[model samples]
Every structure is written in structure tokens, then in C-alpha cells.
Target chain A: MKARVTVTLKSGVLDPQGQAIAGSLKSLGFANVGLVRQGKTFDLTLDETDPERARAAVADMCEKLLANTVIENYAIEITA
Target chain B: MKARVTVTLKSGVLDPQGQAIAGSLKSLGFANVGLVRQGKTFDLTLDETDPERARAAVADMCEKLLANTVIENYAIEITA
Candidate 1:
């Protein structure tokens, strides 16, 4: 199986990297650019004899180390 | 308009961060977890009086700053 995981800073968190990128965009004549929030993305290949168990396991993985629960939120999608 | 940009390491690029995460997952009983590749995700709000121009501009932004062409590939999606 294959899975995609996205982890993002929660609303109201300061995203310095995002801000810098947005500023750079504005300077580059991308006047249409507004706010930008940066996050992390991961794609994984897994042993998927059973998807349900894998999903739960991956979610646990996210909570444990993939994301900082106090300031970040994560989502996972599974595909074969 | 709202845009989601995903930037990923090109295939064959070494992804040390992803390898570390996968190792952590395995330690946490996510034995199903296999190879992992890590990337970046961005969510942006843009002034989209016209989407076509905005998309082109965002792509340029990606090419110029958000992603490194030598090792990364990016995809952008627009949502209003």
C-alpha cells in the first residue's frame, strides 16, 4: 500500500518560513500572493495485508513523532 | 483563491528525513511502514480576480523560490 501524510501548523501558529516565502513571492511581482502556511508532506510505501490496521497504525505514528500535536495537525490518505 | 502546493524530492534523491521518520514508525510498532519520502506542503490564499494568471504566477514562484529545480518537483492546485 501507499500512503500520503500531511502535517501542518495549526491556525494562529507563527510560520516564519511561510512568511518569508510569501514576502519573496510579493517581491517577485506576484502581487496576487497573499498568506502562505508551510507544512510537511510524506509519501510512504507499506506492507498492507490489512488496510484498516495500517491506517490506525499510521495515525498513531503521526501522533507519536510525525507531528507536534500541541501546534500541528496531520492527515493521512492511503492508496494502493 | 486558495492554492495548495506540494513540493517533493525527485525520485532517487536521498530523503534522510523520511528515512528517519520511517525508522521511528517501525519502532512504534508500525511494522507495515516501508519506504518513505518527505516533502513540503504549502497552503496559500491569493488575490484571484483571474485564476489563470494566478496559477502561472504561483508556478513561477515555485520555480524561483519554493522548490529547488535540481532536486524537487512541485504541483499546485487552486481552490476558491
Candidate 2:
């Protein structure tokens, strides 16, 4: 099975990387750009075939290592 | 309009960060892990209301800044 985990900063946390990107865009003459938030995406191929078990394992991975729960949030997407 | 951009390294590229993650998972006793790849995700709020225009602008941003077309690929997903 294939699973995708996305880790994003919480709303209240400051994202300097996103701000830098936005500023660079503004300098590049992109006036339509507004708030930019950046995150991490992990694509994992697991030996597990069961979608339910895969989701659970991926969720556990996110909690244990992939994400910092205090400042970030994680979502797991699983495909068979 | 809100758009999400996901940037990922092309297959066959060496991803040290991903390797480190995978190694860490293995050290943590996750034997089911196969291959792991890491990517970047951007949540962009645009001033443009039209979805088509938003996607085009986002694509431009990706090509010009967000992604290195040489070794990386970016996907623009527009919602709303």
C-alpha cells in the first residue's frame, strides 16, 4: 500500500520559510500572491497491504517521528 | 482562491533527508517500511477568484520559484 503524510504548522505558529517565499514572489512581480504556508509531504510505500492497518501504522509514524504535535498537525492519506 | 502546491523530487534522485527518515524509522523498529520520499507542500491563498487563472498563476509560480524543473516536479491543485 501507498500512504501520504502531510505535516503542516498550526495556524498560530510563524512560518518564516513561507514568508520568505511570499516576499520573493512579491519581488518577482507576483501581485496575486497572498498568505503562503509551507508544509512537509512524505510518500511512503509499506509492505502492509491492509488499508486500515496501513493507515494506523502511518498515523503512528506521524505521531512518533514525522510531526511535532505541539506546533504542527499531520494528516494521513492511504491508497490500496 | 486557495491552491495547494506539492513539490517532490523526481524518482532516482538521492534524497538524504528521506534516507535519514527511513533509517530512523528502521532504528525505531518499523520493519514494514519500504521506500520513503520527502516533499514540500505549499498552501497558497491567491487574490484571483477564477480557478483557471489561479491555477495558471500557481503553475507559473511553481516553475519560476517553487520547483526546480531540472530535478523536481510540482503539482498544482486548486480548491475553491
Candidate 3:
């Protein structure tokens, strides 16, 4: 199965990187840009064949290696 | 309107960061992990109301700021 893991900063957290990007966009003439939040995306091809197990494994990967749970949240999507 | 921009490296490009992550995962006992690729995700809220215009604007942003056309590809998804 193919799995996607997205790790994003939680609400109420300060994202300086995202703020910098937003500011750069505004200066570059992207006037309508607002509230930009930057995150990480990972695509993994797992040996697991079952969607349920693949999701679980990916979620475990997130908790252990992909995300900092104190400030970030992760979502996993599985595709056959 | 809300938009998501995901920027990923082209297949033939080298991704040292992803390779490092995959190696770490394997060391941490994630044996099933394979073919990992890392990408960036940006969530943006635009003042524009039309979805089509929002997507176009986001795509332009990708070309100018978010992605490197020489080695990366970007996908824009608009959600109302």
C-alpha cells in the first residue's frame, strides 16, 4: 500500500517559517495571500498489503519519527 | 477560499532528506517502510471567493515561490 503522511503545526502554535513565506508572498505581489501554514508531506510505499495495517504502521511512524506531538499533528491516508 | 499546495521532487531527482528519514525509520524497526519521498505542503486562505480563480492564483504562486520548476512539481487543490 501507498501511504501519505502530513504533519502540520497545531492551532495556536506560532509558525515563523509560515509567516516568513506569507510575508514574502505579499512582497512578491501576491496580495490576496493570507494565513499561510506550512507543513510536511511524506509519501511511503509500505510492504503491508492491508489498508488498515498500513495506516496503523504509518501512524506509528508519525508518532515516533514524523511529528512532534507537542506542537504538530499528523494525518495518514492509505491507497491501494 | 482555501487552497493546498503540495510540492514534490521529480522522480529522477535526488532527495537526501527523504533517504535519511527512511534510513532512520528502518533503524527504528519500521522494516516495511520503502520508497519514501518528502514534500512540502502549504495551506493558504485567500481573500478571493471564486474557486477557479483561487486555484489559478495558487498555481501561479507555486511557479513563482513555492516550487522549483527545474526539479520539482506542484499540485494545487482548492477547497471551499
Model 3, runs deviating above 4 Å = none
Per-residue lDDT of candidate 3, residues B1-80 (tens digit): 89999999999899999999999999999999998999999999999999988988898899999999899999999998
Compute each candidate's TM-score over C-alphas.
0.95, 0.98, 0.98
Docking class of 3: high
Q: In model 1 chain A, where is the ten-residue run with the lowest total lDDT?
A: A49-58
The fnat of each candidate, in order, is 0.93, 0.91, 0.93
lDDT of 3 at B30: 98
Task: Spell out the clash pairs found in candidate 1.
Answer: none
Q: Candidate 2: give its CA RMSD in angstroms.
A: 0.7
lDDT of residue B33 for candidate 3: 90
Candidate 1 per-residue lDDT, tens place, B13-45, comes to 999998998898888877777899999999999
Give the per-residue lDDT of model 2 (tens digit) for A4-70.
Answer: 9999999989999999999998998899899999999999999998999999988889988999999
Please tell me what DockQ candidate 3 reaches: 0.92
B1-80: candidate 2 lDDT, tens digit per residue: 89999999999999999989999988887889988999999999999989999998999999899999999999989988
Evaluated at residue A24, the lDDT of candidate 1 is 88
**Which model is ahead, 1 or 3, in terms of lDDT?**
3
Ranking by lDDT: 2, 3, 1
Candidate 3's error at A8, in angstroms?
0.6
